[model samples]
Target: MADVEEMLDQAREMPYGEARSILLEQALKAAAHDRELAFEVRLELTEAYQYGAEPAKSFATFSRSVAEYDADPGRWSDWHTYSLLWQFKWIASDMRRFPEIPLQRAYDALEEMERRYTQAGYGSHAIHTQRTYVAEHIGDRAAADEWFHRWQTTPRDDMSDCEGCDPSGKVWHLAWMGRDEEAIELAAPVVAGHLTCHVQPQGILSNLLLPYVRTGRLEAAAAAHLRAYRLVQGDANYVDDFGDHMEFCALTGNETRGLEILQRELPLLDRSPTPSDRMHFAGCAALLLRRLEDLGHGGLTVRRDGSDVPLDRLRAELESDARDLAARFDARNGTGEQTRRLEARLAAEPLVEHLPLTPHARRVAIPVTQPVAPPPPPAPPSCSTWPRRPGGAATSTPPSPRGSVTTPSAARRTGGARTRSGWRPSWKASRRRPCGCGSARPSCTGRRATRCGGRSRSAGSACSPRTWLWWRRPTGGCSRTATRAGAAARCPAWPRPTRGPAGPRKRSPRSRARRRARCCHCWPSCRSTSPSRWRRPARPGRR
Candidate 1:
């Protein structure tokens, strides 16, 4: 009915891609008339989504196929059907991970698993394990302990997890209970590399970091981090486990080392498929950053994928994300346990002064260093970073006693001579508008600057001097700029500094007050600056 071989080949080619899921769904539709072929597609699709952290689709597919299998038990072989029961364990475990799926449903799923296992003459190994996981999810230590006891006593059968995973899960339980000695003892084989799997040694080691530390085995604890992190650093599925490594580093006064772990695994935050995993990793990341902030590295930047982020800013963002996720879970679970736990982690005190991770490393603690800020840019040769205001009596040359503007250009304007500081402009002054009717020695043969409204004192310009604000100027021509025109009018962008017959132009009361009040950047008062320069705001409560 369907081109089963072709679809299967496509799925194999893209074993972990969205295309594989698409092809499987297509094959499933094409094989609806063929029950066996449809069942086969459902099986592959279920496994794909399950392992890929897509619990919803995987569970739905399992339910659909299991109903078909139950209708006619002889339709599939024992091997092909075994996945149905085994995958139930994951479904039950995931139910607890998501609070939206009612917690009661998790219990119901376990009961259903026990019923199915009994009908198939199977042991309770996997069901008991899932029950323990659900109990732990709700923070029910008493129930978790009871389920854990049953799981350990249950006989292993074909339905049980693999040898490698069984002991690793047990190690997690033991460590969680704070029975450090028992956890370490049970994990001896896995820790020593005797019991190995694609996921074992790393999973076992990550769970053991705190256990090893709490038991006075700091050396082994450090060793476990290095070995475990190496294996799991690149994988998103192990993000939660990587979080354990991060928290261990944070609590042991190895925040710098934890930072290295964060830099390598930071990208996993973008790709992690599980919500619970994302939540845990984010919380742990915040923990490491909190430690760094404590050590004065809050101003440092973390480089990732050709971009750098501020340590403190990123820390705040990740902690917010984790808290938001925890709130979602807590709202659904009708408890604040998740919020409580996260707050506790954020508030945890360090467990050690320093723990050197390398073999035969020094016992002395590494000193914490402050983040180094970049140096300020160099100033121009003649002036500091401060803008030169001719009116100021601060560092630079002060205004003349007669109050004629003594700008850097003043010396050359009077003559081609250099000033006392021995510096002069290499080029002539740029053109600017002129203003005001005033003069001293020689300009247009002393015809005198008439009060003409922005009009030149030429030909027939009959206009009165219209008073212009010190700052405002007309946009463009009815006028044009000259190379420092020697004449003055009534209106221009700025009134050119001049020697008035009236003895230093009388200042308005407001203008005088502003001149007396110096900006923090430009101190010692500036009486002659009509259009003031930019100033930095004084810090609060100082000026």
Candidate 2:
């Protein structure tokens, strides 16, 4: 049993019970009353338990193994200590909340593992990394940070090159501490740099990106995700079973992409035998659908637990899918026409639900309008050409770029004018006001002006008669022009509120009406004039 190579060969070919019995007997005999035998038997039993589904038996044997070693110090060996420490992590993970031991004992066990690793000289990096992780989780931030620094500062030994001992844990620890941005930057050169590949590029990226997401750096997370995607290279088993690609996609608000990947992997899950493997796919699918519902993406209906999903019109599509599955089986003994009919039915299944478009979903799907190039900033208002003093209005013919207009005081003031072509609010505009109507607006105490619902409405306000325009149009009824004209006629000499320097800036009649109706609703007053209200403060004293 202590001859690991020979025993492993036989175990590979033998049934579980037979293999366990042979390994147990030989492991016990190898040391003949030595504490080393006790440790060996424990390791052998623990290995068997790890691969088997019987937790009770596995833990029972493991506890017994620990007891035997405790009873005899002479039997302990460096090999036993190292193997036991490694297995301890697995046992702790599986047996969480079992209450067979206290939490402190688990900590003690991990500390013991650190001691064992130090004694072994090799695997010190692995133990250090694992200890840091446990400390971090157990709320010992001081201990965790200390271990983390050691992991970062200490030089790696040859054993640190092992895939299992890679600095993945340390990188993850850094990420968990709200240092994800730093962690990513640190890991980047290492992961992409050849000298850093020794750190296990794929595994570190997989663990590090998870924190990047929580920190609101989705772009960085996406970069890491691309690396993971590249690593899988589109292997269905790796994507569905090992990589959790679908869950990753769905949780991160990329449902459509995730579902596409899942559909591709579904066939593999259908054939997978291992319960754990099957559960990974099934559980991820279920969670993803739930997330879609949470995001309000599910159609009129949603499926849960074990029911058909809530995809509204997609119910028929699912039934069609089921029918297609049955027909494929039925066609095993049927004619070609049967197969053709099945294929046709399956092909007819709709790829997406027939839900009404949601404002949010539509917004997400809609292409964003980009800013058009702004016309060159109006040449700085030059005092030399002004017909009046620098502080006074021009009284003479204004200078024009092409000298087209000769009218005195007729020059449009482009000094603060935003280009109508690209109407984004200028940094000055934002900084100049706290977002009320621009300077041209009147005080609340000014005379009331009836306007259309759209123009004056505050966000989410209800419309009322006060906000409705009193003017009626010709028999064709009020048009956009009629609405604008009616409001302007009712409120003469007032500047139409502009939407910053943007193009064709005006509130719709509906918003104006809503605004009038909600007058006493205590809406947030747009500050348009507060000196510091602007998004960016105007250059001091120059305005």
Candidate 3:
């Protein structure tokens, strides 16, 4: 037994293909020693094969394990038998590509598992949960509801300690019941915390996204879709979840990105995906392409390696694949329920178009007892209220005082100035400080001047004429005018103009002649010299 366990552990540490081979070899060796040990080893081998995408091999191995256990039931415990039956039921149902067991066989297996659980005095929550799922899949709403209630009310002590399993199952049941709003409410916290197992996160979040979208909760739907997408991307083991991710992408205007993912994953489908996986991927591809067709891109094209393939052709191919897979499932399962559902879902009519923009639940508003506060008083009219100046330029005015406002033009016309104390006559007219250029100085002639050589002006002095000139000129700095006309009339910085020489000196005749001679040597066009003569001679020895 220990040797079998050790071999299984070692197999787990290897890649799926290698692990499946090792486990199969170990199971054969263990069969020679003990039937019980052989059964355990084969169980591990079955999972390895499944993970490696060899569903046929996995089903055969699992069947052998079950037969070995049945030959001598005393060798295996009830718990082991129950677990085996539970797993077998799911595997059988998922055999959509090439089913080896009928749907009735899966249901019978579930019934046997339930009997084993009851015989062992254990609650049948897991059994009931699986029953609910099967019922829902077959569109047996009443049976599904009854099983859901059974699962919900049953004690969970005997159920596996998978943290996400219970909530994810409940969410699925609620969503199928058309109670999507309730399902989303329950799933929001789980998705937010990123609590997920191999199976639950993809199932829970993907199911939640549909509700979110239907209820105008696009942001939440997008977030859930992204989380679900990241969970399955690059991991072929989770291809079962890929269809749900693609469906969300199509509904949420992410068809382009979804199409890229589909193209990338298409090659993997040919590499021996399970029947369920093949059906799912093909059905989702068909549905998405159908939606694209309905959106007016009837001749949509998929580009690969500079080659373009019509989307309709791709859709037709996928639909054919899905139908073929469904036919195979129906052949083995002896029931076309799931296949029929798949065909119905992938029909040309758009399912998303029928979804409501909001949830059916009405929001209830809570009443408050506190009195509402009054709104603040209107603001005083701003300087913007003043008329434009005669030149069509906006006049600048200071912010209005607490009780009174002053317009620039009005202040100028009234010959009054606003001061900290209040409105006052303009510095008593005569006593007002002279302009920075000096009251005795003449007005600017609008000509350029030499650099200042006067005494350094005080830092607080008014703006200089150069500053004012720059402020007033179109291409100069400080395009905005002063807030007050009186201030605009004065230099912001009062720097006195220097009396230095103001213009460039005239060049001497000899200097002018030399410049012309230099120019003639540089360019033959200046003196009409021959091109060869105009060129400077190379250094004597270098030539």
lDDT: which candidate is best? 1
True-structure RMSD for candidate 3: 19.4
Candidate 1 vs 2: which has more TM-score: 1
| Clash list (residue pairs), candidate 3 | 97-275, 461-494, 462-491, 462-492, 462-493, 462-494, 463-491, 463-492, 463-493
Q: Alpha-carbon error at 516 in model 2, in Å?
A: 70
Model 1 Cα lDDT, one tens digit per residue, 213-313: 88889999998999988887676668888789889999998887788889998987877666778888999999999988887667788886688999898
Which model, 2 or 3, shows the larger TM-score?
Answer: 3
Rank order (by TM-score, best first): 1, 3, 2
Q: What is the TM-score of each candidate against the true structure?
A: 0.63, 0.39, 0.58
Candidate 2: regions farther than 4 A off: 1-7, 10-45, 48-58, 68-81, 88-101, 114-128, 138-143, 154-165, 193-202, 210-247, 251-253, 260-291, 294-296, 299-543
| Clashing residue pairs in candidate 1 (N, C-alpha, C atoms within 3 angstroms) | 436-489
Sequence-dependent TM-score of model 1:
0.63
Candidate 1 ranges with C-alpha deviation above 4 Å: 1-3, 6-33, 303-307, 360-543
Best model number under TM-score: 1
TM-score result, candidate 3? 0.58
